[model samples]
Target: MSLLGDDSTESVAETVQETREVVQEEAPPKTGSTSFKLARLLFGGVLAFMAVDNFRNLEETVGYAESKGAPMAETTVPAITGSLLFGGLGIALWKLPRLAAGAVATFFVGITPVMHDFWTIDDEEQKQQQMIHFLKNLALLGGALAFLRVGEDD
Candidate 1:
């Protein structure tokens, strides 16, 4: 059965051709966006900067992750931060957008709740600070999710 029409004998090639034509006809022309490009650059820059900062203080970051009860903190911290560095740069350069978005989204999802569990904090000030970090991660996750949609229209 062909998805392009009711014809049961339609070949895959024909269906693909028809679908391609339809998509080509329906897709809108792409628009240039200086603002979007700038945003990508900034978003990527921040991630890269944070990764570098964490690397510069690798022992401190590892210790902090250990304090948070993270297993294999010694190995995990550098890997995660390294991913952030590459993901950020990839996104900023638009070199590997889908991979970059995945990398970023993965980082946020993996670390945010673990690192910023405000519900687990008893001190009011610390809880507030963790909550702020949690919220910031949520926003960054949203941005990464948006980046995942970049090539969808194509």
Candidate 2:
């Protein structure tokens, strides 16, 4: 007449209770405020937008590279690749943030030298601009990493 067998019922109940306790125990503590969440969302949104913008300007980017003395084929190819890559990365940050942040930080570190190379610029003003761009990217990378850490707490 008893369902789940008399012995199995007690064991099943115990298992259910244990599972609930474990779930509660492992649940993440609420550490982030509403403002922190909003800031994170804004940071992520801006990065996503920039990615789309970069993709939209692929052709103009190629032209800029050509003007900078890059080979025609090489310039165009990298522009397209970078556009697609950054756009994909932006989407990733929006969807799977931890992975995206890690990838972006790694990418920024890897490209920092080429991005900030003072020797590549002939004009003083251009060199200053490049430095500014380099610092901005570094800041963005830092912000992304910080966002990832904050997200993990949420």
The top-ranked prediction according to lDDT is 1
Model 2, 42-141: lDDT tens digits are: 6656665655665577677566555555556344445444543553355344456566566556656655555466568899998998888788878977
Per-residue lDDT, model 1, residue 75, is 95
Worst 10 residues of 2 by lDDT: 84-93
Provide the lDDT at 87 for model 1.
87
Clashing pairs in 1: none
Alpha-carbon deviation at 146 in model 2, angstroms: 1.4
Worst 10-residue lDDT window, candidate 1: 27-36
Tens digits of per-residue lDDT, candidate 1, 4-101, equal: 66564567678899999998888442424788788889998899899999999999999999999988999999999988888899888887888888
> Highest TM-score, which number?
1
Model 2 residue 63 CA deviation in Å? 4.3
Residue 76 in model 2: shift from native, Å?
9.9
